[model samples]
Target: MAELSAPTGREPGLRAVPRPDGTMPRALVIGATGYLGGRLVPRLLAAGYAVRVLARAPERVRAFQWGDDVEVVEGAAAEAAAVRRAVADVDVVYYLVHSMAAGTGFEEADRRAAQTVADAAAAAGVGRIVYLGGLHPDDVPLSPHLRSRVEVGQILLDSGVPTLVLQAGVVIGSGSASFEMVRHLTDVLPYMPAPRWVRNRIQPIAVRDVLHYLLGAARVDPAVNRAVDIGGPDVLRYGQMMNGYAVVAGLRQRAIAALPVLTPRLASHWVNLVTPIPRSIARPLVESLQNDCVVKDDDVDALIPPPAAGLTPYRRAVALALGRVEADDVETSWRDAELSGVPSDPLPSDPDWAGRAVFTDARSARTPAPPDRLWAVVEGIGGENGWYSSPVLWALRGWMDRIVGGVGLARGRRSRRRLAVGDALDFWRVEAVEPGRLLRLRAEMKVPGLAWLELRVAPEGTGARYDQRAVFFPQGLAGRLYWLAVLPFHGFIFRGMANRITAAAARAS
Candidate 1:
């Protein structure tokens, strides 16, 4: 096989031609590290199809086991050259890339990216294209996010390639955006006030079922090109979804009072305040919640036999979601975008927010090994290490904060191999230490609050319980404002930090 030309800029115009490898299927998953892509690839491989992934930063998609198990090509799917190279030898091209967090330009970005993939696949003579899009009613006023999904699917269809576009709603996976929203809303808010969308009905699918559908599509002959509506056995309201999530997550049922006052914009602000999703990303998602995304038709199910791919019930899916959450093994959800190595500018700040005292409390139980073992994990806390989920994001945010007169990671600690008290650790200043028992750092960042990072060790079973916390005390409206604004981010960053430390602690032990 000759080296395929790497995509440079825009994809060139190309005609759909029969792929030479049609007899032996080879599937290429664009955004293969994503929640859907991650699971889909393994299934495809298991089903006897050769699998390849096109990742912008291949390292971010760590869940994919490499080393001859899968082929990983590093490049942006939006780039025509990259897409062309990725599709050249593959029979099936899975268009799984979307810019949900790209904000206002998301639609245009999504369109261009889809066009690039379609054009590249067409040029490469790919056998078929499989696209997964959010389900929406054509008559209903679709939110920009959902509309982009529908439009992008159209782009793939326009490519003239056999396309199996599966339109789904509210995938019941632990890392899915809709599921995360429900998780946070139900877990954190015991008493809730929400938008009218909460009353809207939606059909949820388990991530595994989604993977089954995609894998089945890959195995079937290219004749099945029609758009399909795939969903779980149950249809429930967004409110019921929240109730189900709470029940599964071990939280009490939450009573939500639907308020007309909470517009999408306001709700986004509130969501951004509570969840780790930024306002830019949360607004579009919140707006889309207005659309009722229940599956309208099941005609495609007849074409693809349901027995071939068994479905998991909504309750079972919820149970799996809970199990994943407790185990913290969620990989490749839409939230992975934030964790990807995208450089996000620091959000604007207020001058009045100056001179506010801040403190952060982080506790980590150490193993028998030296703190160096732990620092190795701490040092790699946010970027490619995934903070263990996605560390690129953690480092990016920490870097941005540091640049804005906040403690960037430059003050992290002493050496990656050594640890001591009063040592300057990245943007943090060491304040207290007791050999291997504890290490505390007082925040020196600019904020209208107090912050601190403390790590303490204790025995748990045969290992140690590593608890990492970021505590913030607001000064006034500014301090309170800042806390609310970055609440959603705390969930991801904090959860990631804890997971990374725990993993590192285990490795050292």
Candidate 2:
């Protein structure tokens, strides 16, 4: 394929068009699967740029709403050929990929990845590069993570590309690392024995503001190529930020005591135990918090004008993040980028059922209703609609889950009538959804083993056959004991559930 032409020194405000014979600037987004990158792609598309993404595992981002809109180049950033292909014929390249969560040797790996992209972009004659880096004062010693970001930014700038590096502190948005840390810390603990770093001043920027700056970078003049520091209007201690979040979330003010003895290692371990954030990523972030990260320059403000409504405040940003959680509209999460390191293929077909101690309770009932009716009844199984069979028993289970730090049943469904692949349905997440045919829910509730409840409807002689299967993959002796302990309840719950669903379908029919 012929390389797309770079953006000419054309008239300002001309949006890029994706035409075969037009001079539309093509923007390539590396790390499109990350939180900010995932959100930025849609904004770029709306701004009339033909966006393309480079991802290691394209399947991971296949669930994105804009997955089909952008072209995907499947390869790792470490590969020279892959980087060349990704940087090919692009007017601007957003280098948003980072490897901090890859455990050890991430700094060197990050530098190598940045160098590869920088060399590739230079070779491709790319017009410009936009990168988001950490905000840290030059006087203070930087943590390994923050230092790596600074190094990466310098590498891009030294590549002779007109690079616009935007340095930001904690991003206050749903699924952002900083926001998640604040959210989990505030929500889980009423009293915190935090480290001295919690008292350090930090200026957080809303994700919306960050995206606005990023989008505006594309329109920035090529001559204005330098690092710009951007942050929210509020500058407060990390503990105060958590307090503000609690206020917005309608939770009681949490009491936090600063302890000088608490090291970053201890804090990271505490975060790992309390929040979903792993120790590997949380350790660096915790260490970075020791230095104040409030922005010191207004260069970005001069380059990119503020949004129409102005920058969002910390409290409002917290409210917005919580609102997304409440509405179940979280666009992307930190968990999405955490690769499982295992193939996500479907369960094996024709498995040795006898070789493994797989326990399953399969129940089938012929319903007078059609498949659609049966499927509707199956789809509306949890949330406000209740479990159809035992409401009290389900509530008890949910309470148990909550006590154990599971999501429990409070999240509910995004829509009571509709279901999607990643939607939360009470204590279970919708793993697979097939309209009028099948719905598989993976249990998120606290349990000793992995469990799935699958419902399938098939055409019968005149109506449909409702099949409900409870499959459990035990881990060890504890898992087996757990199954045995719950064996009696399964007989009552599963059997009752199957009968009630069939009856409900019949009524609906």
Candidate 3:
């Protein structure tokens, strides 16, 4: 494995320790493509540890800014052979894999994966195993998600390998499942009718603090080999969290009313409709909110001192998360992790005659610029840059989308000058991006049908041609009517958009 060069400046609260071989300790992060794991690997590298990542799909991590800095092993944690290969010559193994988003049987899958990893680490003679688990009170009846986390931590500890389990609740950061729920809940609803679980008091930690504790675990005394609960300083209810988020976002005061009739299932559906998070992932998370997740003990502070900057305040954490969102600097999102058990087929893969009538408003324009320049114009569309067509019409559409619990244009594009698969462009999710060739976006707006807006740029003659296609697969008669109703605006909106994009490309060229 290629060694990670030591960073010039060391991260606070992380103590550097050289190995017996006069080299840095090698740490292997399983599930490195995950939100926490993705962020943690870079910290380990900066702290002078030779970092390696084990991911089921290595391509997912390839886009990460630190992708080339660390070694990557392609394999799932469930595979013993893959686990053993990843554990080889590693001092610390971070078992960050979990199956909460996988729906049913996740607990069993997590248990099996944990056992495989722990056993492999023991066989490899790895010094320590660090695992991040959910924080829940031991006295209360834990939700399936929280219970599975605790169970996995036990399996790791029982492997007879010294394991440090850092248990946390509601990680407040951009792209986190918990924080996204809070963010969307506050952003969408001025008056929130929440479930009783929203009243349950819990502690929330910043992702930065979570990373700090994870890095601190590497240098922690080997004797401390048990679960340690970690959380931000404040203890607040889920409702308060939403309100706090509102305050941090500088939005109008949100009034949340707790409703006794709202069940976790119902709340999960509500979260699904309002937030970018799907019901499969949101259901498990909503169920866990019933139990208070505050840190009951402060023993972890002694084992690993708090960072010099100290723990981030709840509101400050929300601000930081929002700032990251606004700046389009979110490193990794919960969506980056694959969601299993939820069966889904790509639009292109679906059967052509799947009882859905497909509609297309395809248009092409010859641009007086090369494919690269035209592609640049394509990538720069949406958000503050607008649609290059009718700004008023786009705003009206966005407002209508927001009224129906859609993401709307406010979510914006993650980058002003680039496009990536899974990045949000207004109410559309980037489905595919091929640099100078193609860009396809799947609409997240509430509509009667599935919609995609695709832009393709190709070298044509002395310059390039831009092909713009607005495709919609209608559900039924309502879908067809919806398409027909919007058909009048197509001539003005789409044609103008194509022309403007061409002009923009020409101007840039």
Candidate 4:
């Protein structure tokens, strides 16, 4: 796709058609599949706006509880026809869609999409265009994610359609990707060794406040066409956010150390292993927060009134979000008896691994047992089954992980004999499960790098070959050192693991 045409500094004369005061304002929400959009739609409906959603996949939008109540446009923001259809006859066109999660060339993708929406909104004469953008300081170099958001905001503002861009800091709430990252990491790890940027201050706004601000943006004065900063009351470091969650969850105080070795880019991948968020979205989310993300001005205050109860504090937001997901027990409920919405609502899929430092250890053992027989033993490896090779070594490793605030082996497999993708098995998450053939577990244990263990059974001769491989994509020098330090144990631990697993399968038969 071609790049967005240069924005003319002179604002164009095109403007959204004004609406009558008592008339129900029509709102067209782009990117309805996103966590923010999904939450925003319900609140918008509850607030009595005539809601419409434009989704690349309309089915995903229809999956929400409030799905049936809104108009659905079937197409992506990148498609001009879709954007035009979505913007038609709408009072407010909300540009909630972004392409950071779309992988390579996300910047261009966002620019193109934002440009498409901006032009469409302008042509349709929408009343106001509201965009939720990243909060970043104007002085420093911005992360790719933040820079793209800033550029998108500018594109919209230059479109001549009255636009109000709400630049929000780290958003804290259930189903929020950033909050989920902190939630899972803090829940699994007691001690976190994070990047130095963890010390960076961030003003995290609750989803409730974000929705409140967005609801207000719908009625914002047409004279407002500038980016406004929005954030919660408290400004705390990234590490403090995690501990605040611990406090709300009634967990022991978490120890957070800003380590120079761990880079936020790799850390993003590590956090992705545990959190249910899509792979593509996690990196940008993590990188964006590497720098301070607090609101710089009270620009939002002038445009939108604060929530009647005031903006939610960081810890209180965490507490409220925690109430949503606390082991099925009745704690926090956004709705009635049944939880209509899950906090782990994931975005579309994207392969996370691209260019990275990779280290691998491949080992295989031939077993007299058949592939199906061996697969049974492989699938039941974690939780109660335990790693076949070494109890002492695995136990020590689990302890080491737990000591550093990792998930450890305490969270066993959900089912003793069955394995499915995304299931948490001990300290490893089931990345892929091809029944009777292969099982790939991504390491959730606190390590210096992103790691994965693959166990697959292949037919060989009259028996089966149980191939085992461990892959590690180290972050920096520390990751390499971490690998070298543990190289000796690979033979004793992995080789025996393969051998013992095959033997167990044979015995099972």
Best by lDDT: 3
Candidate 1 lowest-lDDT run of ten:
6-15
- Give lDDT tens digits, candidate 4, residues 227-290: 8899999999988888888888889988988888877667765665554433355667777877
103-176: candidate 2 lDDT, tens digit per residue: 56878988999999999999999888999998898877888888899999999999888999999888988777
Off by over 4 Å in 4: 1-18, 273-279, 327-509
Error of 2 at 376 (Å): 6.3
Instruction: Please report the candidate that would top TM-score against the real structure.
Output: 3
Q: CA lDDT, every prediction?
A: 0.65, 0.79, 0.82, 0.73
| Candidates 2 and 4 compared by lDDT, better number | 2
Question: Residue 56 error for model 1, in Å?
Answer: 1.8
Stretches off by above 4 angstroms in model 2 are 1-22, 340-509
Give the alpha carbon lDDT tens digit for every residue of 1-509 in model 3.
22222211265558458998799999999978788887777767777888888876564566667788888888889899988888899989998988767756888889899989989999999999999998888777887888888999999989888999999988998888889889888888889999998889999998888888888888888776888999999999888888888888889888889999988888887887677676667888998898777899899988888867689999999988888788776777775555563212335754674665788899999977998899888988987799999888888888786555445676665466766665667777776778899888877777887888899999999899999999888878898899999999999899999999999999999
Residue 170 of model 4 has an lDDT of 84
Better of 3 and 4 by TM-score: 3
* Residue pairs of candidate 3 with colliding backbone atoms: none
lDDT value for model 3: 0.82
* Alpha-carbon RMSD, candidate 3: 5.4
Candidates' TM-scores?
A: 0.67, 0.75, 0.80, 0.63
